[model samples]
Target: MTGHSAVGWVDIVVILGYLLTTVYLGWLGYQRTRTGADYLVGGRSVHPIIMAVSYGATFISTAAIVGFGGVAGLFGMSLLWLTFLNIGVGILLAFTLLGEPTRRLGHHLGAHTFPELLGARYQSKGIQIFAGLLIFVFMPLYSAAVMTGGAVFAATQFDVDFEVALLVFALITAAYVIPGGLKAVMYTDTFQGLIMILAMAYLLLFAYTSLGGVSAAHQYLTGMADLVPAPLQAMGHQGWTAMPKFGWGATGYDLWWTVITAIILGVGIGVVAQPQLVVRFMTVRSRRELDRAVPIGAVFILFMTGTPFAVGSLSNAWFAQHGPLLKGQVVKEIDAERGHALVGLMKETSPGRWEPVINPKTNQPATAPMVVVAHQPAQDGQGAPVDLVSGRAPTVVYAKGDADQIIPTFINTALPRWFGLVFFLALLAAAMSTMSSQFHTIGTAAGRDLYERITGKHGTEPSVLAMRIAIVIGLLVSVSISYNVREEYVIARFTAIFFGLCAATFLPAYVGGLFWRRATRVGALASMTVGMLVSLFWLLLVKAKEASAIGLVQLVTGGKTSLLADYPNWPSVDPIIIALPLAMLTLILVSAVTKPSDPQHLRRCFPQYAAPQATTL
Candidate 1:
């Protein structure tokens, strides 16, 4: 039997059984659902554990697994620090600080979408409309990011065609989501969350031990001190020991800003304003349920994010050791030749076919490098062994032709075939877990924001059916975007860009509406509008350039003039830095300029947790 399929049929049955059971429960949940509230918000009766898992699934995805992890492997461990903040800033502070108020406002105002809540709170439909517009525009991009992550992992690991893989995953999500709505989504997310956490934990421990045990792996990493640069060396970045040096690019300012400040805060802080996530706050039976959810959410994040960060940081240095020659001139050449040589180096270092090195120091029981190679036909009795150091000719080419397909490639090679199957299934769970939730949220917003608002409808069996249909449409749109995303665009980039946009646009209105009584209707509109435009403008208008004697654009983009011709070098700060304050001030100034909205009109403006049991200005 080829090593890839070594697991007996039992593993397949167990994994598929798990999937079927979860899907069935989701369907059961759909059956029990009776109203728009139930379909959209689980009738606002969700348990804390369920909500916690759902939150975890929503936050983490293949982006965390492959996209971010891949980059961490390329860069260094400082990236992992973002995970710490994900829990502290994104989840913890969000839940403790924002959850109650957001939920209260949603209930107080009898709102559903973030827009609806904000509009009703501030006594302005315009706010709701603007909010809806922001979400409708930006959410799809977020979905595309998740899809990008899935594609990268698929292409690298299972060797599936990128488009094909994208469609498969997207369609699968659409199918389940379209039928079941949020109930199906939450149910599946609960299951998928468990699988993701388990998979990451298992993979980390297994890989750590398999690579010649933990102690040896540490020594191997520490011994390769020469691989890191002097600046990096000073900061403890010994390829495996510590963080990367602070700089402009690479493990520099961009990463810190994007990951810790922008993406993390945008995601974590922005949760208060996320129509999809905010609605989840309404799902629970009571504030007590929300309170319960906090700890579970924290633990889930600790598991999901912590494992990936750990693996990503340590594995990055590990891959580098077996990766391309750590040379400046060679590293800058962006050609198929560089890719080929790297691939060769990767192939040669591959232990156990293409598994990760078990131990760098001893090389005893050394596993394959974490890169997958096409299994060519056997020559004689021996399968092709990796040649780890295939420098082209006179210049050590370092395998002369390999790749950095560490995540997927390693998964395919290292585990027993059955375990590989389990790993893939688990990965699917991770993808679907979040994808389902996104589908549910988009549908709910459509139903509540567009359909409910347009139709003036509330709870009903038919409305639930309408929400189901909206789910179908939302799934279709998200999947389509995913299908179209280019292979070059990574998961982290896509997700971060959209999320950054959100932080820039929404955070202003959300926070201001809550705290700034001066926020006027026009102010809310302006804030949302300006924030969105400013964020997008930064990315589109600004151009990034490297320092060069000639010109950065020519040096990097290979043009006679400059790189900005193709694309501008935006600072890539999570637009929140500029957009948030501007949006807030816009809301305040606009409100102050306009007549005060009738105080009687205020009832619909705040959340349930805010100032009202009955809700009047």
Candidate 2:
């Protein structure tokens, strides 16, 4: 309630104008779309700049800006490693090493979707159907993550109900995607990407300027190490400007493992196998187009990802200096039942009576006061208890201080009134661009790869119509999941889960088919199956965070959080670390033992290897 502020008429007009222009572009794409190819791959003639921007925009979603940015708020500047990987692995290697081959193979096989490309390379309907089903089923989790990030910002910005914001956001994105397909998605993505670049640039400049330049801001953040919550410190948090403790803390390398394995590597390497992003390579006409796109894509990613991470880490400095103050008293009394000290923050208006502290900004009772309860009363680490008699401390509390709302709270409270509107538009663009691509990919997976292949209906008209209907169904599933998924840092967690799953399931087989002539259909199939099952098994029974949230282990085992809860660091390890290696080994062993692919098929897939050799007479 304290952060709520009504939008001005000017803001409303600008939002309406942007929405109208987006709708017009979608209509234009609909008018131009004439074939299934156009709907799925934009006729394979998209401009390099547009394609690059679309790929970058789709790759960097609200999940990046809001969800992972929030994670940066807790984990600090260590998240910047992900940005490095985004440029190196996601753009450089992806466009050069993998992009050209994926484009050529997709064209050679006349494939439009990612699953179709892999299926054609292996020449197996089972592979195609399995890949399609995998995508259509689990992709909703990612779609929901992106949607939740957008809705969280929207709800914070407009003071509207979260359900309403989510529903409207989904509808607006579907209006453009279902009718216009990939063409509309790319066309609108170009515009959205530009907006994101501008807004993020402004935010970066503003955050640094407001905090007294880069060095001073970092110094301030580093100096506030003691401000890290006790719970976080025990888990390995060192400070806002430094990485978490390396090997062990109270929980035995739990934070270190989660950061390196689950967050950094899980999403960093996972981008290579993302079905939504891989399909972008097939949208361009030639390798030259892909070549031209590499730098543009790299620069786009650098700004898109780098800005949020820097700003998210620096927000603690700004909040500590300018955030609201809380007035309360720290009470420590012995509990009769437990015979231990009970410490809490309370406000007393009359002697022998206490009430909840009311925030002056909102005139509402504060939910989470800036107090850490322990067996003994909390201390400020300076050897003095935290003002036990008159607990008046300058505290930063923004809407429960939830990680998902950190960026939103900063935008709304720390910046000028007008910039809030601008940032909101940027977030809207981010959410829509990513959601459009996701919905489009899932639609093609269900309609073209699964339904058409299974039912033997390959006609253009029915395929296009089926894709349109499938988009609607996919949206419904995503929205339902978004509504039901309520957890702290849900966006970041779900994004990592989906990315890890894709990397484990698809990376081994996709790379093998493209680069290795000996990769057989059976090998690819076996790898995909093993990768997917192994990843799921790890998520449901091994990884502590996911397994505990899902409650599957708890239900099956009658109260265990994970299968390996007794182990030191196994529960914290990501599925990608465990499953990706096993998957690669499976592909190699199976392909080596099994018969190689047909010579003719290998010739078509690897043309350079098949080039006729000149013999000397």
Across residues 218-317, which tens digit of lDDT does each residue of candidate 1 receive? 6765665554433334433445455433454333344444445544565555544556666677677667777788888888887776666556556644
CA lDDT for candidate 1: 0.59
lDDT of 2 by residue, 1-617 (tens): 23535767998899999999899989988998998889999999999999999999999999999989878877788899999999999999999999999999999888899999999999999999999999999999999999999887887688677788899999999999999989999999999999999999999999999889989899988987876765677778888788878774337357788888998899999999999999999999999999999999999999999999988888878766654222233333333232222222244457755666432222344333222222223333332233332334432222233567668767876788788888888989999999999999999999999999999987644479899899899999999999987777789999999999999999999999889888899999999999999999999998988999999999887898899887777898899999999999999999999988889988888887887989999
Regions of candidate 2 where Cα sits further than 4 Å from its true position = 248-250, 324-401, 460-462, 613-617
TM-score of 2: 0.89
List the pairs of residues colliding in candidate 2: none
Candidate 2 at residue 157, lDDT?
80
Error of 2 at 568 (Å): 1.9
Q: What is the C-alpha lDDT of each candidate?
A: 0.59, 0.83
Name the best candidate (by TM-score).
2
